[model samples]
Target chain A: MTTIGENATIYREQHRVTYYECDQTGRATLATLINIAVLASEDQSDALGLTTAHVQSYGVGWVVTQYAIDVTRMPRQDETVTIAVRGSAYNPYFAFREFWIQDEQGEQLAYITSIWVLMSQEKRKIVKIIPALVTPYHSEAVKRIPRLPRPIHFEADTQTISKPYRVRFFDIDPNRHVNNAHYFDWLLDTLPAAFLLQHDLQHVDVRYENEVQYGHTVTAQVNQLPVAEDGTVTTSHVIQVGEEKCCEVTIRWQPTTQPQA
Target chain B: MTTIGENATIYREQHRVTYYECDQTGRATLATLINIAVLASEDQSDALGLTTAHVQSYGVGWVVTQYAIDVTRMPRQDETVTIAVRGSAYNPYFAFREFWIQDEQGEQLAYITSIWVLMSQEKRKIVKIIPALVTPYHSEAVKRIPRLPRPIHFEADTQTISKPYRVRFFDIDPNRHVNNAHYFDWLLDTLPAAFLLQHDLQHVDVRYENEVQYGHTVTAQVNQLPVAEDGTVTTSHVIQVGEEKCCEVTIRWQPTTQPQA
Candidate 1:
């Protein structure tokens, strides 16, 4: 049993700097950042005395539902970054978690927050987060968790894709919804790598609107995030593209999630 | 919006099962079983009009936390199976989902359930699940999820692996957990494909225990799983055939993740 405090300032931490995680600029892609979130989450779960069996004993398993992230920076090839992650709060049936990304210089780079749920394995239904399981970590949380807004998907008025993109066989995962990380590829593919590196994500939330089946394409688009009151930086996404309605989204800038330290 | 009707059931839904999801028996794997679940969920999410972006807006992303399944049955290559999935429940922060898999002929194969959590994007922390977000899915749910006991991970830990497993550039995923589906290759590498298809996975949960470096050997042992559960199956793996533990794993057979129709 390893304790995160021994490695991270706040909790258990993991560091990685794989070459494949970067582009020409050596910066990590948003998709790669997504991967970081996963690696970190798995690390944190192992630390919390939560075993696969312990989680399964309840007749349910955890699955990522959605994510909203703010990436201030991206790591480049061979550049190691520290992923500091911790658990936040939950009702009785969920496991809400948080993640922080920093460079070797300890420069803050990205922040991620996500939602998860428990489902019945046999009946294949959603179940609640059992308190007895989460109580231990709820008390050990580092700080307060903020509430995030639900995304407004435009599936009703969304454009129908005519040209189905040739989906790669490798994109599929154990759960098969095009590995969530691949979303970065479709997203960043719309723009030049240089543009992606120069601009970090301030805030982003993309609710999964539909499935992009193999040999079937989903329209991709980008548009600005709805403007905020203080006239703060705005958000934008490649509003609509592709034929299937899979859009490339980008937000102006909102320093939410991971803060600059 | 689309919804999974409770009382209304589809006796046998024909599915065009893909090929990449198979094991030595030429069938889908338990790890890939999750991918199958994802496909059905995406279809269901779309039926509900919830796009990926829409889910992201909530600042919470859903990710798998736990899972329990008996491989008493699994679908063979090209065998079509019916998928029934629905929203179970979500309290403040987590959403529970369920899935049922059967053969085209309507035979039970495996039952699985999982839990997910919601978190904040800006603060990178867990947050409450707002009913407004989960209200869309109208289905019966449970407060507690069932859990499965994980088998004991090998204890003779050693990390001197140097055999050199090439980094299949293709094997890497966006969030990079060594694509769970690829583990089969490593496991079956030493044996003939004929020898591998003889049994099924009753249950499996590997910790990844450690990362297999970009150019290192990933020795494995296949002793534990098929034993007393049968006891005839046995295999041992170490960094070097005679070495201690660099990586250790056990596998058992019951039926298969893909059940016959």
Candidate 2:
């Protein structure tokens, strides 16, 4: 972590977007964007000497529960972008962190606000945030957790499209669970390919309810809301393993001219 | 491309393996290793003014047909390794390239030899190597194609385990087809997780026979051979889209103590 001001601690890293990270439109996929943000936070934690192993030694691991992302534009292939992250505030149970991506010109491309909680590896339950575990980066301690906008629940009356996906071995991280970023792939992939090509994702609100395991076949259910007056489209998604819901996501997209394939 | 010695052109890049790229045992996945090698070759192509877009302008794009990989050990998470690649030789219809991974101490970890051919975008058929495109890499032109070891064909009598995978949107690259590296995931994931955890991959020979497109459900069929005298196990995999075969792979593994998950 680098000190920008007298009290502000920020961690920034430069990464060149590779072709494999992009989709058919030459823009980074939603999962790739989220992965880059998570990578930046992990780097920050490493710089603060609060590595994953160190935290695991305390019988807890950091797990993301929610993310609110606003994208002005997705990073393009071969573009060098900067990812900056900082721990903002924390209460007894939840920690709020912020991440932003910027192009080489310093223009911000996306901003993400995320909520994290300490989870007991053995118990598989949320644990209270230990003060010592998050004290190194100097985040403020607060009594009340911040209330961020939550993803909307799936509507019963809306028409839905569902797809089934079996979790692969590569989807499992070292923590023995599917990584959070992979949920985006399962969510957005249910949409029509033509719709994905003609639209640009503007905002996303995703909430994780339960962890998905390897070898499990999960169903992604998606429902598209009517286009807004301003020509933007909204969609709600639910990921489930059998009858148990694992994640919920709401996304807004702005239609663009058809991209040349 | 950098000149290591007179008449030798090489491209090398350093990458720190992130935790997301590793499996539960903290070692990089087969797809991740192959992706790193492909990234190095792409970087070399970019440096030599043979960018993908430039090649596509001629109505053709490079496609990998086969890969022969030998791994001493997979790189671990947070380990910075160097990936080096160079064009070795080319024929009228094929190009041969070599890639290797090295630790910080310069000890080699993995080596890959790949065969590439130009595929016409319109006809979707193999095209002869253009002299103008091959001249920049300075690889020797040979009349005879190199005879690399081929992946063994699956036997009809052998029992096979099959898993079906629907290609997702993110699986498709800028070329509008699933990237070749993704085949490794489908092939390796068919093995029992316990088997994967108890073995270390030593060598692999994969041959790509057809391209897989988005929205296709491909079945991965895997069969294991009897253990050899040296305690090595060999596995054969075939990826099929309905009646058409897309890929074939053979992998050799050495049994190790069960990894601590």
Candidate 3:
């Protein structure tokens, strides 16, 4: 097994936010933000000699199950930001990873914590975390799985606005499944354009329950919760493939001081 | 007006292809390839002090009307490639730009030629090309407008496979219109997954007819043409919003030596 010092567990890279990565507001979309964080972890894995091919050689591949993200503000186009990731801890079946984005001045922009599990490629079942896989990152081995926040429960009777989407071919990643980041697009896109343009995302909790395949038609259902005393609004979203729930997400938003033009 | 020497017309930047930029075959998607080329031209504009903001200061913005791309092969994930763009020539109403992607060994991978026009941001009408704008790029001022090949006419009576798509919020750019690259996704997604995995794209001719807006439900219609004697297949695509035709594309594909697993 490849070994690394504990101090080298964290990996960081600088990236210039390009126009295509941003939305109409000139700010990076939530999906792009999540993608940047995921890429950071992949970079860390590459640096530690634990490439995806190496991990899959044991007939298993890593898959993210959940993510809880906190954002101060979305990075704007043309801004150069730093993305950092570190393997935090791993239990028998789950691995915990942390990712953060910072501006050039080192001010934090967004923080994300994610849960990943190894799945058997042949049987498509969760596999036990192997020590060799986690050791190179110097992650702590713990018996107790950490409890991250779960997405707010979606009420079945609540009034909702939904949008149906046909999975595009490009949405499939190398694993031949719709990418996790694309889920964010479908979830957020169901919201009213006015609300999306007027509010800034503060927190997001998302959980993936089922894999979505190409050519599958999925519906993104969203319902807004009562506004908090602080004027913050929360929205709950679920992506469904007919009767099957594919993913759920809850997002908190604060009104922007200057709404997009 | 900022005057650049003719020798400085070409601009080049190196980019590392990331996993998120690739599809199931581990090759960069057509939309991502086009975006990279557009970004390269934007970088060139920035270098010449002819930034988008500077151009928009005159109440006009550049809009790409057509693209003709020829690909040798798609760049693979994790490969570092060089993207280069040059402002070739311009007339009273049009600007022609050329872009090319090269592998690490400097072997050409793709070449794209595009036509751009300045549009009045307020009136949304085509504006005459200002000499002050093209002068900064050192593009040749010519009287004749270059006649590039147009996308093959899509016959109305041809049987087509069609897919409907809702324009997502993230699809809009800072200009509040669906970005040009997203159309490629809608155009190519209508093809069968088996065909996509077995064929390599050789050429793409796309022309944007109208801007697609947020919340618009668009349909992508595609029909295959007879295969060439050389076994190359051609497809014609049209993106429509109800009765309005938004964009048209014609793509040629050659069977791959090894189909994707």
Candidate 4:
């Protein structure tokens, strides 16, 4: 197994900030930040010499089970931010990964940890994480595999919250799954663009535990108000399938960072 | 007119190199590059403070009547490239803009020139460039606006070639027109994926002169092929609408700058 030492492989995702990603409010939005984080994941996989085909070769692919991100500060439009990621652990079922966003000074501004399930691409059903496939990463900090607690007392709060959406075909990326950033597209579209554009989602603490199949129902049940901070509301949402928790997203929004003149 | 000096605008576009744009070949796919160029055009409009809402307020919106671009080099994966654009000319009938793409070292790689029409977005018909809207950029330079030749030599080649495609609703971006990148998607999809992945398309020279309404049939006609220094084919094609030249595309393939690794 690969370990993070002088010899362990660590992938660094380097990038600079651009204007288009910034809104009238200057800070990078949570959606945009998630998009960048996904890129870092791809880059990390590339560093492992894993191409798109390699991921698909197993007849399975990684689906973001969840993203829990904490942002201490958001970079401005012209500023640079780097996301570095490493495959932290893997069990029989899920591969655990940790990601960090740092400024030019190397100060970590945000951290995100996520669980990924191996799934059959064609059937879109969860598959066991092949021991051989994930066996290589155990050498690096093989500690307790942090179980992403299915939100305690987590209930969809409503069986009638059927958030109907037409899945855009192009939303399916080369990986043959909806690009994880697109999940925000599904969740955010329920809000007005004017409200979304003006506010910045500062912290995203989400747990994705289940897979939503193609041509199936995606019902987002907002359980409750998770937190209230800085004049914006934070809601806890879980996509459901009757008795099972498919996915959960907790988003916190605050005033957008003002744009630079 | 919001002139930088005496010109309404003397400007450069956002040079972006997002990794999400590159395909398995480690180069930005033709479709992604074209889409970014479209974003550059949108940025130009945004900088001019001419938003879609602002244009719609006048009962007209500028629709891409045509586009012709010649790509001399395809930027490598993760390389930032710039597109320089300027107003070529404008009249009561139509408006024209010219653009060029360059590397960080200022080496020109792509040249694009397009014609746009102020159209009523509601009724789907052509109209004149709004005078109040045109007043801002029309100057002495615009007075002697050059009649850069439109896509010519259409009547000589009547041999027909046709391909049918369904326009996905997502193909329409925020602008409500089919995203310009979708044109490249249509163009490239006609060829075998193996042909696209194995061999590099080094140069693309294309011109757009008309609009393809939703669900319109597009026929790609190859008119000529010129031999290249490296023993590759340079194909020139024109997409036509009966008697009208909608677009002309000149592609030079097997460019030498491809990464061998």
Cα shift from native, residue A193, model 4 (Å): 4.6
Q: Which candidate wins on DockQ?
A: 3
Per-residue lDDT over B1-261 for candidate 2, one digit per residue giving the tens place of the 0 to 100 score: 322222437789998887777988888999889978888888899899998889999999999999989999999888999998888778899988888899999999998888999999999999999987877887877776566689999764547899998899999876677877888888899999989989999999989998888989999999999999999999999999998999999999998654665
Worst 10 residues of 1 chain A by lDDT: A1-10
Q: Is the docking of candidate 4 incorrect, acceptable, medium or high quality?
A: incorrect
Query: Which sequence of candidate numbers ranks them by DockQ, best first?
Result: 3, 2, 4, 1
Model 3 agreement with the true structure over B69-155: per-residue lDDT tens digits = 999999999899999898888889998888889999999999998899999999999999999998877788877656667998876
Model 1: per-residue lDDT, tens digit, B1-261?
123334222222235443334443456755456656655765566566665457777765554544445454777655778777766665555566666788877777766555555555567566776565556666434454333334355543343222223333234443233443344445434443334445565554332223343323455444333355544453333332234343343445543334432
Clash pairs (backbone) in predicted model 3:
none
Q: CAPRI band of model 1?
A: incorrect
Task: Tell me each candidate's TM-score.
Answer: 0.42, 0.95, 0.96, 0.58
DockQ of 1: 0.02
Residue A50's lDDT within candidate 4 is: 67
| Stretches > 4 Å off in candidate 1 | A1-10, A139-145, A152-167, A174-178, A192-198, A209-217, A224-250, A253-261, B1-261
Determine which window of 10 residues in candidate 3 chain A has minimal summed lDDT.
A1-10
Each prediction's Cα RMSD? 24.1, 3.0, 3.4, 9.2
* lDDT of candidate 3 at residue B243, scale 0 to 100: 90
lDDT of 4 by residue, B1-261 (tens): 223214546457756565545554556667766666656766677677776678889888886656656666666655778877665567677777777778889898777666667888788688866766655543223443444444434333553334444443334444545565666655555444444555666556556667665445566565334466767765556665566666776665673444432
Winner by lDDT between candidate 2 and candidate 1: 2
CAPRI verdict (incorrect, acceptable, medium, high) for model 3: medium
What DockQ does predicted model 4 obtain?
Answer: 0.09
Q: Please report the candidate that would top lDDT against the real structure.
A: 3
Please report, in order, the local distance difference test score of every candidate based on alpha carbons.
0.52, 0.87, 0.87, 0.61
